[model samples]
Target chain A: MTKTKKIPVSLTLASNRDKSDHLAGFLSISPWLIGFILLILGPMLASLYLSFTDYNLLSSPSWVGLANYRSLLTDARFLKSLEVTFTFVFVSVPLKLIFALALAMLFNTGRKGSSFFSAVYYIPSIIGGSVAIAVVWKQLFGRQGAVTQILSLLNITDANLIGNPDTALSVLILLVIWQFGSPMIIFLAGLRQIPIELYEAASVDGASKWRQFFNITLPMLTPVIFFNLVMQTIQGFMTFTQAYLITGGGPLDETLFYAVYLYETAFEYLRMGYASAMAWVLLIIIAVITLIFFLTSKYWVFYQSEGGR
Target chain B: MHSNKRLLSDMIFYVFVIAIGIVMIYPILWMIASSLKPATEIFNNAVSLWPSAFVWENYPSGWAGFGGIGFATYFRNSVMITSIVVVGTLLTGSIVAYGFARLEFKMKNILFACLMATIMLPIQITLIPQYIIFNEIGWVNTFYPLLLPGLMGGQPFFIFLLIQFIRGIPRELDEAAIVDGCSKLGIYWRIILPLLKPALVTVALFCFMWTWDDFLAPLIYLNDASLHTVTIALRNFMDTQGSTSWGPLLAMSSLSLLPQLLIFAFFQKHLVQGIATTGLK
Candidate 1:
């Protein structure tokens, strides 16, 4: 963690201060450096190594030479987990973003008590992922749950959302959509940053509200939308708590998320090497997905600072 | 006629807003209502907000949790864990943020970039290795595994947040302190730390909420039922057997929502301000 620095004699005092400044900086940030080494960097390298080997924690890791990655090609459960995670991300992210954006627009109308309602709406995102919430959700969609009762009132057939394999994943997606608060808040903030003058000018030009929204508002919000897309996609992919607690990846493994599967492999099944490989694959997938988003962002994500067209 | 039309539109919009608000909060309201219903009446009256009978015994019975461990233990464990973790996050997050925000050090840019990168890194990549490390040290089944990493500034998000905040403070303040014979640490303590109260509160609030609501870490580390968090304790009530007491489970579940709901209610402004300030950046 050391580097060489050349200092001119004319700045001797400043150079002397530079050495002390470096020392102070290191001292102040040493906790993060220590944790980064021990918790982050150490585990990262170890996982990378373990991804290439076979180990079950009791024995020494024996190098398997890409065996883990090779095995994933034919591993049915592994493939299933990937499919499930992709489905979760692809379905939940857009729905959550759309809901968030719509709510943000609704709350951004300068209506009275909009902030209070916004805060109330943000409550689910605060506590929605808890084991308690997951349990509540499980019951709410259970055979005798309120959802069933409501549907019964509407003359729809009774169905158990959590117990039925075909509809179990949709329940989880509904939970994700329910917690669109954080993004809504961010979208609200982004809406505030959009100068009001554009909307006023559009109104003066006889533009309708929808026309003003598309022509003036949506373009200005592309950056924030792009930001939410990447963040929520990552979050959607990493979602584990609800599936782990509520679904247990069950009703025929219909909801076996990647993280849930990874946990089962490492701890439940004690296949550390295989789990590490799965982890590495997940990392690569997320990195590639994020890279794609960044690469594709140029065309759609407009910045006001760049003089929006 | 135009003004009347405008008033009508505003009224419709307000009605729409209130309808959505009910959709957002109905599940929670249902839980609270169900908690007050008799066990036999829970599912029968699930859709109704008014209970046929107010079962006051549910709260006490739920408090006397499964196997007699009680919800009190879980609540206390949560409090102890969250408080320590919050203190550690604020202290370590602020100190490290100060370094990144103000100080020039070797490899500063690269280290800062790594910090930012790790903020987006999925926890799965490091999960197994960290588990092994904690296992080797015999920190399994203890709060150590849960709280220790936080003490070492393991939360990159909080550090990044506090860095953004500290960076916004004028450098002239630090310069003045230095001229008045303030050491670097002195300036951090006397000048910068005071100004960082709002950000610190934000960090503390987030730390408390996340740790309190966290299920995976406690479920993994604390295998003992007595050592479980409220989240895990709630899970305990729903045994695989078909004999789950819905009255007590929903009661405890409603109680579990209390702390966070209270925090959000009181700190509504701070929470909104924090997210707005941090997000827009």
Candidate 2:
């Protein structure tokens, strides 16, 4: 050693501080970094490779490049799952958002105990997809379900909604719409963020509620709308427990969501490679959808804080 | 006249809110009511709000569970797993989030972006490979596969949430502590940890609830009857081929929902704040 400790107190202190700071930072975040590599990145690469091979857990994976993807083009179940998933996403996201925003707007008028009401409304979203809830929903739509009984009171008979293929998906969609709590909460937050002065000025200028909403509220809420859109779309695609528990993808595979189908393929049928390909395709679809939104967001989404569009 | 109109509108508003709240809570209310009803009465008066006869035996029967394994075991397993996960998540999540929020290090931006991007990647895409990895390490059929990821900063959502929270805390405290010759770890341990109580509580509540409610992982990983979670135990009630006992099933489900309902009622403020804060950003 060159007797570095005796060189100078301040010099050693400053240099040692930087080293310690860097070391501490590394040590602090290293867990996540290591986890991200082993769990996320490494698995992703393996999944990509697995998509091209025919791997069952029983044996080693054997390569057959593009075969799984090619098969997907002709696979009827795969196409049906995509159709079901896309329809579910496209239909449910807007309705849920609309319902959430309407309730949020209603609550945003600053009524007494509005928070209590909002919390009550959020209960379904908290436990909507639990097996218990799903089972309860199944009973609610069964032949002698609460819905059927109510429909009977209206002089309508034999209202078997869950058993019928035509209306089963609609029942699930209704369940999704019912659990619009998070978006409702987020919308309430966004609604609060809109400046009260803008609304006051609009009213002073003799603007009607509808006109003020169109000009003021909608523009201010676009960012939150966009956020909700992306999240709800992903959630729509990932809906599994409800479909798996409620319908079990029955009545001609009407509600066989992409995720449930992929799960059956991977775990039940043990077609791991095929399922991996399906998973990748699902990922790509979401990425492209989200990318399109991001690309088009600049045109419509106004950020008043970000240089005023 | 305007004041009368406002009063009438307020009346309408209260009615509307109450009606909507009833609709929102009807299913859960129906479940509790049906749980108390006899097996025949469940379907007989499915539309009815109240049970004609209260059958308290449903709770004991449901708790007895299937094939000698009771709901007590499932509840015990859930509590054990969730407690471990919550503790591990708070520890790892706060540390990683603190690093992202406060520390200056190389690759920080890239790493942060990577963490954010992982939030978008569907868990299914990584499911197969992870299953293989867990199997390779002989962690399958054990809680290790389900529990270890949470322990090792696997939940990026919590990390992102805590990072947003940690960012909101003032840096003056850290600076003052540094001037007092505190090391980086010392500042984090002494000041940041205590200040992070609210966020930590939110994180713990969410972790516990999500783990308790989680069915898919426990389903895929734990094949043994003994290691089944509450969700899976509830699922087993449906899986048996014979005539399904709706009373016992609904009774157990109502019991299972107690924790979530209690947590929501008590932590309504924190829950609302947590979502608004993390989600809006």
lDDT of 1 by residue, B36-106 (tens): 99888877777887899788898999888878688999999998988889888888888999999999899
In Å, residue B48's CA in model 1 sits off its true spot by: 1.0
Restricted to chain B, the TM-score per model reads 0.96, 0.96
**lDDT tens digits, residue span A102-207, model 1:** 9899889888989888998888888898877887788888888998788878887657878888889998999999998888999999999988888888888999
What digit string (tens of lDDT, one per residue) describes model 2 on residues B1-281?
A: 99999999899999999998998889999999999998899888888879998899889988999988999999998888888988999998889898889987778899999999998889999989999899888888899978886877748988998888898999999999989998888888999999999989988888877888888899899988899989998888877721468889889989888888899989989888888867721
DockQ for all models: 0.72, 0.67
Model 2 lDDT per residue over A89-194, tens place: 9999999999999999999999898998998888888888788898789888877889878987898656788888888898899999999888999999999999
Candidate 2 Cα outliers beyond 4 Å, as residue runs: A1-15, A155-159, A307-309
All candidates: TM-score of chain A: 0.95, 0.94
Model 1's chain A TM-score stands at 0.95
List of clashing residue pairs for candidate 1: none
Question: What is the C-alpha local distance difference test score of each model?
Answer: 0.88, 0.89
TM-score of 2: 0.96
